[model samples]
Target: MKKLNIVFMGTPEFAVTILDTLYKSTEVNVVACITAPDKPAGRGQKINQSAVKQYTLEHDIPCLQPTNLKDENFIGNLKAINADLFVVVAFRMLPEVVWSMPPKGTINLHGSLLPQYRGAAPINWAVINGEKETGVTTFFIEKEIDTGMVIEREAIAIGENETAGELHDRLMHLGAKLTLQSVLKISSGEFEAIDQSQLTEEELKPAPKIFKPDCAINFDWDVQQIHNFVRGMSPYPTAWFTMHNTKADNNKTFKVFKTTLHSSKANEVPALIELDGKLILALRTGSLEIHEIQMEGKKRLTAQQFMQGYRPEEWEITL
Candidate 1:
């Protein structure tokens, strides 16, 4: 039984888990790591290594950070590794040259169960859509992103009010476990890759990348929809809105981190409302009580704490 030669491609902490597991496995030889190039990050603009790069370096694993995946030089180096299988997690879409290089085909561990959530930000979109359950999927990479045939899937319930950050961590670990299982099964030569098209049990849902406008808070939405939106974007690309003061001060943007939904009858014209000595943003049918928030150029604070220092006066939700 020869050990499987593996090359892992990934970028974030989520991807590190999959690469790390294969690296530690005795049945496989993790020859090299391919990750995103180090780029200027943070306020100091220092070159920051990706999570995958940091992990590989710490473990003394060989790594390649190709600025362009199609570079012949990078491709040549990859061919030298002569890997049996390539595993992808939380990584960019691969060029066919890279994915097809491995004999056993490239394996991808996705954050959501596919054919559903088949795009960049599956975990976030799942929570944003108010899904009650979501899980990880391991598949064989093909030309289309995340449309690869399914190797295996493990379902996990999404917490009722879990933020995307929370669900991401959960799926990260779960993806690692499933990916390991898939590798071992592949090594044993006793598995079948199920085409995602065969799974007609659930209607397909797309989890496209979320942009700036997608995270904007729309007060006209119902309470539950807004609640899901807030939680989905929390702790990253946070759901935000512009605030205009009565004094005609420069409008500031505030990111909503946490909130509590309060249902009520017809609200009073959908404006900021005071109830039980708390600041609640009125919506079409209910109120959204912001639990934690961060204003531009200001530290995070609870709604109560923020109110003590500032007054809405004539402040209103601005576009």
Candidate 2:
């Protein structure tokens, strides 16, 4: 059995797991890696290396970071690799030339069960919509984004309290294992491709990209919906709101990192903070027991720590 020459493209930490798995596989030869160009990040605004680039460098794998996917030089270099197959995980949209380069064709490891959630930010959208289950899928790359022939899929149950961050880690490893399985099957010409269009249309749910506005907490909604929204955006561009501390004599905004729900009366109004003791806010359905929070122009701190310097009367959260 001949080892398949593979070209892997990805950018974030989620994508690194798959790349690492492929590197250790005996039946797959990763000829090279493609990642997005380095961009300035953090407080100091220094040029930062992408997760995929870091992994590739550590493993001594050739990496290409192109500003434009269709650049002639970049395309030429990719062609030079002459790989047998192309694998993409958490990467940007590819031009036809790139996806069509490999003889065995390119495949992507999407975070969601396909035909549904067939767009960017699937993990977040899944949690936001209060889904009970979600999974990963490996499919051949077609002209339409995420609308491809499915190669393999494995569903995982979503915990009620699970945040997007937790789900991301789970799927990252799951995707890695699934990708390896798909690659091995493809190499042996034993894998079957199922057209994504054949999946039931009635069950489809779109997973479009989320923006800053999408991250804002809507207290008017039900407790379950609010809870899901918070979890879905946890640990990244976190769900946030303006908090005013009347006792402190200033209006301060804080980012909510961790929160738990508490039961409330039926007639209670949404977003109403029944109790504002310390850093906790009581909502109609339940109270948001803030665990970790970050204040404007200040470092992240625990609820008790934030309360120490904050006055309940002076600061009030604006819904």
Candidate 3:
């Protein structure tokens, strides 16, 4: 059997796992890696390399960082690698020249099952929408974005209390395994591609990129909806609310990191802070016990720690 020549393209940590797995497999040889250019980050503002770039450098694989996908020089360099296949994960959209360079064609590993949640941030949107199940898909990249033909897929059930961070880790590992399977099967010409349009669109869901406004909490909704929103944005771009104290004449915003819903008979108004010496708020359907929080210009702290030296007589929360 002939070893397949592969070129990998990715940017984030989610893509690094599959690259590591492929490096160990004997059937595929990664000729080069393509990732976004390093950008300034942190307080020092030093250039920070992407996860895929770090992996490629550590493994002594050729790396390419192209600011312009259509640049003649970049395209020329990509063709010089002479790779038979291209594997993409957590990367930006590719032009026809790049995806068409390989004879065996290009395949992408998407976080969600094809035909559902076909966009950026699939894991985040899945939990935010309260989905019961989601999975990973390996597919043949077509002209349209994420509207590709499926090669292989594996579905996993979403836990009732699972957060976006938890789901992201689960799919990251699953995507790696599934991508390896697809590569091996394709290398031996033992796989078939299924058109994504053939799948039923009756229940299709989109996974659009999240923004800062999307992270703002809306307390007017029911408890379940708010809970889903909290979990979906937990650990990153957390759900937040504004607090105003009438007696102290102060206003502050707090971001909620972790919370649990508690049954309460108090009919406190929505977005109202019911302080019992701790940070507890009343939701539309139930009460919320804030586990972790961060006030403006302050580090994250537990509810107990936040209440240690701070006490407000009467405070109202604005959604």
Candidate that scores best on TM-score: 3
Ranking by TM-score: 3, 1, 2
> What is the per-residue lDDT of model 2 for residues 141-210, given as tens digits with 9 covering 90 to 100?
9899999899999999999888899999999999999999999999999989999878656778999888
Comparing 2 and 3 by lDDT, which wins? 3
Supply candidate 1's per-residue lDDT for 22.
79
lDDT of 3 by residue, 1-319 (tens): 9999999999999899999999889888999999999999999999999999999889999999999999999999999999999999999999999998899999999988878998888888888888899899999898998988899989999887778888889999999999999999999999989988786666788888889888988877777777778888987868888888777778888888777776664345764444655566676578777778888999999888877745533667754
> What TM-scores do the predictions have?
0.93, 0.92, 0.94
* lDDT agreement with native, every candidate: 0.86, 0.85, 0.86
Q: Better model by TM-score, 1 or 3?
A: 3
Give all candidate RMSDs, comma-separated: 1.9, 2.3, 1.9
Once fitted onto the true fold, the runs of candidate 1 whose alpha carbons sit more than 4 angstroms away are 263-266, 312-314
Query: For model 1, how does the per-residue alpha-carbon lDDT over 1-319 read when each residue is reduced to its tens digit?
Result: 9999889999988888778877888888998999999999999999999999999889999999998999999999999999999998878889999999988999999888888899988988998899998899999999988888899999999887789999999888888888989998888888999988897687788988888888998877778898899999988879998888778677888898987776645464556655676777777777777778888999999888888877755677774
Model 2 TM-score relative to the real fold = 0.92
Write down the TM-score for model 3.
0.94
